[model samples]
Target chain A: MDLAEVKRIGALARLDLGEEETAAMSDQLTRILDYVAQLEALDTTGVEPTTHPVTLGEAFRDDAVRPSLPTEAALANAPATDGASFIVPRIL
Target chain B: MAADSDLARLTLHEARDRVTAGEVTSAELTEACVARIEEVEGSVHAFAHRTTDEALAQAAARDAARPDPLPPLWGLPIAVKDNICTQGLPTTCGSKLLANFRPVYDSFVARRLEEAGAVILGKANMDEFAMGSSCENSALGPTHNPHDLERVPGGSSGGSAAAVAADECLAALGSDTGGSIRQPACFCGVVGLKPTYGRVSRNGLVAFASSLDQIGPLTKDARDAALLLGVIAGHDPDDSTSACQPVPNYEAALEAEVAGLTIGIPKEYFGGGLDPAVEEAVRAAIATYESLGATTVEVSLPHTEQAVATYYLVATAEASSNLGRFDGIRYGVRQEGKDLLDVYKRTREEGFGAEVKRRIMLGTFALSAGYYDAYYGKAMAVRTLIRNDFDAAFGQCDLLLTPTAPTPPFRLGEKLDDPLTMYLSDIFTIAVSLAGLPAVSFPTGTTAAGLPLGAQLIGRHFDEARLLAMVHAFEATGQGRPLPAL
Candidate 1:
């Protein structure tokens, strides 16, 4: 991956990398990606790719009323809160 | 304490006795621990955040307070892996995104420790978002093995392992999704227990893989580990995923007799890629157990080799979704830019480390349409096979034994350049996680270089008490090795 691609991936990850970090990460990630790409070369046509190694099913609780975190406490550490609601900058 | 002084080496029970008898105040102990950190952390880099003043203040208050008559862990100094949150300390998970983010609430385990009068020392370093097998992926820097400064401590719980080995803390808490705690504990020659999933609450723990993630104890020995587990384990109403099961007296379980027990040795564990030294150490440990009247049965976890691949896919997918909240407007670091999109992009670009980004992309790609069934769905099916492998084996024996890792601690930067080599570190560890079983890594012997070698004992679901008894039996045989000289 190029530095620009690194910057793009970092952007997608919601990070702020400096020029030096971008350059370094680009090189490091390139090698890692190249290694992962080896998985693509395998004959996975007949073989299935594994996701979770444990034999488990979906983990969801029944929809029932339970005590929830109070609004003030829930949003206490939110970076931007306005009147008990998280205030996010508008899209576009 | 001198730099080489092993004064911080006292067991949790011994330290608590000293504090309660007025021989040493909690402040004195915390100071000694902090002093050890100052003496050795420069080379070890075990901690991500050190709360010296906070810990000392808490320790002093604990010293002055009336007795609560709680379990043995009261007033013990403890380090928590950065993935588990503390109210005032930075809960970074060794990732840049949450590097400066402080949780307003404590995890269930942290709160329980405080109620039990244990001092929270600080947050220990880990792999970024607990994604890597080694702490090398940490946004800050790598945590070196206390036994050999040139070698990695093993991770994403490496910091906790190193701290325990260096006498920085009596005990610590680390999360294991795929051997994050056990592998590092093995590498550092400390005791690490990955309790059965849902055994501990994940409320304040940064999630990597929800189904598999478990918060556990890393200590100097099995008895100390049991003490910490006694304080931390059990159900929390806040975490619905936590098991609604009774918390047994783990310490009492330690004294339980272990005669006529059956231990399984999976043939798969002794397969290719295992270092001969590790194999030798593991066999010696098993023989010690056999001497304790335990019989070993050769078993198989046939799908064990596929665990790493399946884990990466499932864990990465969950990590990608879990980390999606840090888009510059929520709980962590933000970087301002021209517009809302630019702001989001730049913040993430600067905040997340490379390893975090790589997992996110890999996970996102795997979960994306047209690939989900082939990658994720298939992996889940394979997971069932792996779990069945354990199910079939446990029917024949009470517990399974394996080397915690294929090799001992590797030199720093040895596998940092290759994700495959790094991923292989979890080869032995991930299988237990895949099977959703409880496993603990205890020091069994030393490598040729005198680094600690550990053997892992995997127990049936919710059978940690039995595992503890078995390990205690082995430890009794004098095979429970001590820390290596740094």
Candidate 2:
């Protein structure tokens, strides 16, 4: 909820909130975090957690080849694109 | 029938009959639907975009080019949840990140519907990235329940439910990840089906939690629901997660009697927090089903308490990863700055809403190297236990019945400021997501305040036929009859 915590969370989320936005979001997020934190107070100590509401398996499908959109169609809306894929600024 | 309300009252089958009989042309039906949208949509906020021209054009073509008798659902106007990609139409998932991004190809379900001659009415609003149970997180605005303008239509698929409830469209497609489809259907007083995961391909759905997401129908009646499901459900070679199970004729199961079926009533669902009115309605629904010849039995799903925590961890983690593609370099929103990192930072900072950022952060924290085992890994283990609980329960009973939500729809902004309360709106629904089983919600009745109440019926994995049969029987008994308030 503090600036430091906000910065840490932003980093973890792969986001970069500016100083002003960070401070604002920190306050807003603090309220939510505080509310969600109440879940910890519940006595789920002996309770086993539930991951799904219904029972099922890994739900895997067989790998098969299907038609892919041609490069022109696939990159139709790309702001910038190379011959076969998207082009972007150098990360380094 | 008043054009303003005629389209709203007609079921998909009825609409199809009229179109085929020349009582109403597809263009007339489409115009009526568009006019209905124009009238009530200001209050309901169900549609994110209204394709009046496109819908009418499609309907006109359906009427003009009918070289043979119309197919089932031919010329019917149906809405699509914004999360499903429609070629040339913006598929925003109610997020700023993809607000302007349009796909070049439609999702399998979207393509299938078009092939079946259903006119694309428009796209309905939803939670940002389909992350929240309440539609409150939508970048546009909260979708109001049609019965009452003040209350929320249960979400991540609130728009679809509201659109159907308000008669904006004959039926709409909704995606269910932790009860996104069923919960809102309950809140809005309509029928929402979450077909067994994989029964419907997830190929073009914008992923929230990939493993749990399934596209289903939100319709005015069970038979319409079956028709919609029949068109949407099937194996798709394009999706690696698509199920190979045969898609049964759901309509054939519609009139099937549930005389000898076993319905399980879990004690946990009727516990302390359930609203008195909701409890009464769901119990009455169960009693009605019993009178129809189905036997009721008490069953236990012991690992119920930890569902919320486990769901958050797993869903957030998967969402965190699935959403990673939204950097400025991708297909949607882009915020310019001096350099690459700045672009990433600026785009995300401006694109994601407060709730989305919160989940991404929590998911990142859970998936972090040091905490993965304590959080995400542990959550997975707990998910297995929950699945096992359902498996054991299914052995004792054919299907499980419970209230769709603890309470009926609350006012739109009531829980907006309280995140936990909003999250808890999905408590009854998340367990079904975790177990990856099929469930549906149908109207039970109304609360004293006049909002709709709904009940949840869950079936064994890949047993959507049985689930639909049960819903069909319930619908026949009129237990889920829509109230007169709306």
Candidate 3:
């Protein structure tokens, strides 16, 4: 991975990394990517992917109403809140 | 005061008996720990937040009740990792982003401990979002290893393990995603158990890698691990991933016969880069098992080298997704911007530390449009082979034994700059997490320099009972490291 690629990835992740950080990430990510490239040597043909270690197929629960977090409590931590709703910057 | 100090040093199971017999008031024990924390926390930096006042109050209440048959965790003062939420206390995940965030509700694991009458001493420090092998990544500050203050208490569960080692808390709750709990326990010379992936609920363990993460116990001894695991391990409707299977009486299984057990020694684990002292201690541990009539066989994990590479991709991808919940508007410290996108970018940029940022970008790259198939998808497929290796090995042996870490506790800041080197520290412990098997790290012996060297015993899924029993049996042999003089 190059510095430009690292910067692009940072942008995709919604992170505004500094120039030095991008450079470091570029060097580190390149090493990590190169290391992981060893996996390509092995043919994983017909092998099923293991996403969840223990795949508990769809945990079901009763469709009954339970107490939910109060709006005030949820909004309490908001950086900008007007009692009920969180205030976010204007979006298009 | 001497009574308090003595009580502080007692292991969880030992203290439980004393408390049950009315030999020591919970107040005395709690005060002892509080005093100990006050004394050594200056050097160890084990806790992110201390709840001495709350813990004392809780202890007083437990003494007042003095039930006929005490609750399992009655009078036990324990620490919860900062990542696990506790309603009235802050849960930081050792990050600046959630540094001031007070959880409105308790995590499933925290609730279980409280329900069992355990007094939570505080939240332990960790690597930011449980991202690093050493606690140096914590925004709160690094946790110094109690044994050698200049060295790291292995992490991202470093504080939890350190607290238990220093007797600040009888035990602690730590989450393991690629050896976080066990490696630190090994470094701190304590017993740490990482239960099967779904064995314990992950309701509020701030997700780093959801697929690999499991909550476990870090305690002074194997029996304590069993006691703590029993309290926290069970199905919860709150966590869909929680196993519905019964939580076995881990304590009862302590007398499990190791005589007929077959322990596998992975040849790959005894390879290059493994410290000679670590290998000797681990080999001696195997001999000790042999003396108990347990036979050892060599097993191979052909995919061992690729495990770390595969883990970074899989874990980073999951982390990037999970961390999306930390956008500026909802909670935590946020940097304001002209618009929503700008706010997110600025908030995350300022909030996250170096290691966390590196991982987010790495993960984003893996899951990005053009790279997903090559990186993330390939990693998932390789993860299968890694898991399959364990399943095949378990076919021949009841458990697998390996050195918990390649080396003893390294000096603080030694591997800080090199992320790949830090990642390799968990080599002995990571594959077990990938396989979602139950494993425990217990002190085998110490290096000549007196640092802890641990042996890991990996077992089949939901086989924590047998794993703990074997660990208890090994600990019973009394060939272990002495406590660090904090």
Candidate 4:
């Protein structure tokens, strides 16, 4: 992968990188991608992919209203919180 | 309590028996562990965050209660991997992103430990976001191998295993996505088990790979592993993927007899990166089992060569998704930017370490438009073949034995520059994670240099009982469990 591709991935992944990091990431990602390329030699035709190890039936929980965490307690760890809401950068 | 109290070194079960017999109080045991931690923690660096006061208070409470028929883990101090959430305690995942973050509630495993009456010593260090095979990736700081100070304790569960080996805690909880538990347990000369996927709840674990992560025990021996596993294994309503299979009395399954049992030797696992010392130690284990009346059969996991590549694809892809929640919104360290999008980019940029960022970028690239099918999809398909290989092997033998890591404990900074080389460290342990089978690693012997050697025993899905039994059988001969001279 090239620096441009790495930049694209960084942006896609919401990671703002410095010039040095971008260049380093590009080189490392290239090597990793090339290493994983060994899989192309395998004939996996008609094989169903296993997304997860176990395929369990849907789980159901009781449909009863339970007391949830208090708003102050839930927001305790937030970097920026205004009592009940978590504050973040403006979207608009 | 003396700074070097031997009570701190007692195995989890031994401590439990003493506590139940009233020979020693929980407070004294807790003090012994605390004294031991104070003496060794500066050098070992095993804990990410120490809960000394909380542990003392918890231990005193256990002493005060003094209930008839004490609980199984009552008063035993155990270290938990930092990735698992503890109520109002720092669960950093060894990353700066969550450095100041604390879960408002306890994880399922934490709750189980609490109810089982076990005292939690602290949150143990790990590879940042549980990404690297060495603890060097931890943003907090690296944990050194207790066996040899200059060598690395394997990751991402390095701190957990080191804590157990150093006797900072009697046992520890470690989460394994790809050899995180077993590899370190091997390097540190302890017992580590990765239960079958869905065997343990993932409710409180900080996700690295949702499909692959499973929490298990790192302890002094197979009996401690079984006791700890029994407490943590079973279904949780909070975790939808947790299996509904009945939890067995794993401790009861520990027997010295290996008669009528068949163990598989996966030929693909031998040679190549396998160190001669590790191979010889593993071969000796096989011979010991043979003498105990077990038969050994040759088996093959032909797709073993592709496991690391597939694991990187699968684990990183899942990590990218799971970590997207770390955007500069609700919790953790955040950096301000012009807008919401810029905020996310900057917060993550400043928060994640080099290894965590690398995996994120790779995962995003793989899942990006046009590349998903080639990278992620192909990996999943290859993963199926890997699982099929295990299925075929299990069809021949009840268990599979191999080296936990290709080599013994490596020097700390040995593979830091080469990510591919670091990834290969988990080669023996990765495919088992991919197949979602249960496996355990116990010390086999130490090399000529005194570095520990570990052999793995893998069992069928949900067959942790048989797997622990086999390890116990060998352990009964006083064969493994080499104590680190640390």
Q: For each candidate, what's the DockQ?
A: 0.30, 0.35, 0.88, 0.86
Deviation of model 1 at B432, angstroms = 0.9
- What digit string (tens of lDDT, one per residue) describes model 2 on residues B71-150? 77788999999999999887999998888888898999999998899999999999998878778889988888888888
Runs in model 3 lying further than 4 Å from the true structure: none
Best candidate, lDDT: 4
Chain A vs native chain A, TM-score per candidate: 0.71, 0.73, 0.92, 0.89
Docking category of candidate 2: acceptable
Q: How does candidate 2 fare on TM-score?
A: 0.92
Stretches of candidate 4 exceeding 4 Å from the true structure: B1-4
Model 1 chain A poorest 10 in a row by lDDT: A48-57
Error of 2 at B88 (Å): 0.7
Whose lDDT is higher: candidate 1's or candidate 3's? 3
What TM-score do all the candidates reach, one by one? Answer: 0.89, 0.92, 0.99, 0.98
Tens-digit lDDT string for candidate 4 (B1-486): 434379998999988888888888888888898998998889889999999999999999998886666778998899999999999788999999999988999999999999899998999999998888879899888999988999999999999999999989999999999999999999999999999999999998988899999999999999999999999999998899899999999999887368988999999999687899999999999999999899999999999999999999999999999999999688889899898898899999999999999998889888999999999999999999999999899899989999999999999999998998999999999999999999999999898888889999999889898888888888888875777676
Positional deviation of B161 in candidate 4, in angstroms?
A: 0.3
| Candidate models: Cα lDDT each | 0.80, 0.83, 0.91, 0.92
Q: Which ranges in model 2 have alpha carbons more than 4 Å from their true place? A: A1-6, A18-67, A81-87, B1-4, B67-69, B483-486
